[model samples]
Target: MMKYHPLPAFLSACAVSACLFGGHAQAASWKAFSAEGGQAPAPLVLPDLAGRDVDLSAFKGEVVLVNFWATWCEPCREEMPSLQRLQQKLGGRGLRVLAVNVGEGVPRIKQFLERTPVSLTMLRDADSDVMKAWRVRMLPASFLVDRHGMLRYQIVGEADYDDPAQQAPVLELLK
Candidate 1:
């Protein structure tokens, strides 16, 4: 019988995801893509850094940026500050940024946050179930959900959230 080690499996998955997304590395801007007839994705329910259960459904009637990331991914780390700035700029205007961390402990995440210091919703995906649910084949993949909970756009690589072009798509969704 073969045994499964979490670290190897996690690393392998990330490696493959990164390779698949490497071609899109030049895509530094968010691209707008609507789901079929604006059909929302599967329900996402995960615990926040505080251990409180946060449901994606709860964010209905608001524009939400669901970003899948990890503390170990350099690109993921790089894009976080922009996300924070985006959050700060539009948060009061009904924009919510949910940074879903895949396969990391709270202590590690907390440590990273201490250094990065982003004030946004941070969710823990210790099992990467949410990552697979969202079909996030890459680290730092992001999706834009409209006010009606429909997924309207997705970014497969690191993005400059502060860019007017990137903010425009999200801003329009909030309207």
Candidate 2:
């Protein structure tokens, strides 16, 4: 007979609750990265859909929004179009949005793109190494890096990038 462990299941439920409720409350706000005791992020280099290497360091002089997401995540899907719009509205102002897809293949990501088009730079973390390196524990996680490449603000749930309140932090970093 197999033994059942309640501890693991309880912990799993707690994690899910945290992701669904704890983070959801902050969706409309940006949390200062430094307040979380976060420092400059580690180096990141991943391949785009075309397999070309995209390095985070390359965008040092510009504000970069690094978002970790997966196609199956509902919140991730909901916020994608807003992210694209944000890029379009601010790309000329030195704001770059890097949507990092976690642990998904090219075919799946391509399919998602076909259904919901987005022009933001789509990077792949096939092995989830970059995701782990960035300590992303939940879907739709975002971190804003300033022009000097310092981590600024972050949010762990869906955010309407089109919202001026949400864009405030990005604009501040750009300045």
Candidate 3:
């Protein structure tokens, strides 16, 4: 029982190190975060369509789904109604959705709203600062923030909000 091989010795050391470092890396597997298509929405502060401050901190006690979009992006146009439906379905269950339109004017957004039933709170980054900050490379970037103002999950492209796979995390946040 006195054998000392370098590889096995290293493995024993690693096992002990892992035991000692247990639970230290609470969040280590997020290096390759993929939300629908790309990275999640960046933490940002912007104004709603009404120009009122709509920062993430303001919705601390609720599950917030912040989606970044634009009027011209076809995918953005395609997925909005689903997001609206998601809002309607989960409204009473304590879900807040902020659709942040990047760099589009109020009139354009208002005009786009006329054709869809997107009734959630619509925020506008008129100068695109939030968009850049959030690194939104795609049209419909969505982030699910928990009641504690922490981003829990995100999807970069179009997602069927009604899907159970997507809803599970959201419900968890609400709880």
Candidate 4:
């Protein structure tokens, strides 16, 4: 039988509860930065939970939010619900959230999803190559890509993505 790691699971559940129940201080607001003079990132090619290859280039002409995360990260788990809300709010306007899970198997991700459901697109980067290519050193790094496929903004940490202020830049990119 597989041993259950109760500590990590309990801690992650606590983190999510804190965020849901008045833990605003733990969540950081995203800072908008200019991507001028920087080359557009190479295409993000990774497998979905179904093992189908998903390419970021395929999302050209749409505003895409690429988020690098892992099931082990508490903050990442906390911010997931808000990302789902953001996707629901702007999906009709061509906004897509691609959540890239770093260095984890489908079974682990499946277990995490069972505990915390998110409707956004989920991709797996089991080797973490995509995370390295995007220079994501943190657990919940996020980037906004314009309709033209250019990198426009980035959030280095977790944020309340459903908040209007945090959604401003993404909405603007859609225009």
Candidate 5:
């Protein structure tokens, strides 16, 4: 058997490691979108619970956290309380958390929210227009919009909204 040189062995290991890690990094990169310094993303307009037009543009000067969720998603349900805690902790400081319920009727949402003890400003995306416009492929997707209406961070799964470390980004922009 031919002996492999230590240099070649190290190089081979490095190459394989790069390839494996690169794919995972690439996938994670796509999971979130960066704002590139407060640049407004593609515009969207959706209605709130009262059926009034709540245009995304209207929240220009506020740090907005838009969460695309559903009553059926367990993770979404799990994170709602955290989000509510986050909102209550920070809502007074120019933070707007819009919990957009995807393709659900008001009665169902109302019934659900009435029992659950989370206090997020809920919006009904019953027609799914907002969901489609935002290209929301997964449930419990979240986007942090800066005060200037730029799409900053996009988290594609359930997250701890109340965690001080996780909420650091939101807090930084709020200041």
Candidate 6:
């Protein structure tokens, strides 16, 4: 005879809830990389949808937002348009947003974009290698890099980039 353990079931439910709602539960704000004792970001060189290799180091003199997302992530899908708006609002002022799709083929990404339609630079991480290197545990992870190529802040989950408060960090970095 086996005793039913409520604790295990409770924990499992909690984990699922966290995955589904954690991003929204978290305050939508940038966390300072230095304050968290995070190391400089790893070298990032990935292929764009056009098969052109895009390197993070090439944008050293500009504020870069590297966003990790996937087609299946609801929060990621919800937040992408806002990211596009952010780019259009700030691109001329030296802000570049790289939307990296993790573990998805270009065709699927293209199909998603066909429906969602964002003009932000799209990059592919077909094997999720970059996601692992960046220690991303959730969808919609965003990193803000300063003009000097140093990582300044990070957002662990979905954020409305169109919001003034969210835009403030990118604006500050541009200066």
Best prediction by TM-score: 1
* Candidate numbers sorted by lDDT from highest down: 1, 2, 6, 4, 5, 3
lDDT of 1 by residue, 106-155 (tens): 98889899889998899998888888888877787889988888888888
Please rank every candidate by TM-score, starting with the best: 1, 6, 2, 4, 5, 3
Error of 2 at 27 (Å): 3.1
Candidate 2 residue pairs that clash: none
lDDT against true structure, model 6: 0.81
Query: Which runs in model 6 stand beyond 4 Å of their true positions?
Result: 1-18, 35-39
lDDT (Cα, tens digit) per residue for candidate 4, span 79-105: 899999999999999999999988778
TM-score of 3: 0.73
TM-scores, in order shown?
0.88, 0.85, 0.73, 0.83, 0.77, 0.85
In angstroms, give how far residue 138 of model 2 lies from its true place: 0.7
lDDT value, candidate 5, whole model: 0.71
Candidates in order have lDDT scores of 0.83, 0.82, 0.68, 0.79, 0.71, 0.81
Candidate 4 stretches greater than 4 Å from native: 1-27
* Residue 24 Cα positional deviation in candidate 3, in Å, after optimal superposition: 40
- Model 1 score (lDDT): 0.83
Relative to the unseen true structure, what is the C-alpha lDDT of residue 94 in candidate 6, on a scale of 0 to 100? 99
- Give the winner by lDDT: 1
1 versus 4: better lDDT goes to: 1
**lDDT comparing candidate 3 with the true structure:** 0.68
Candidate 6's residue-wise lDDT over 1-175, tens digit each?
2233233332344335436765667655788875543447888999999999999999989999999887766778889999999999899999999999877778788888889999989999876778778877667789998887888899876799878989988898888
Cα RMSD, each candidate: 4.3, 5.9, 17.6, 5.1, 14.0, 7.5
* Displacement of the residue 25 alpha carbon in candidate 2, Å: 6.2
Q: 150 in model 3: Cα distance from truth in Å?
A: 0.7
Model 3 per-residue lDDT at 66: 86
Model 3 spans with C-alpha error above 4 angstroms: 1-43
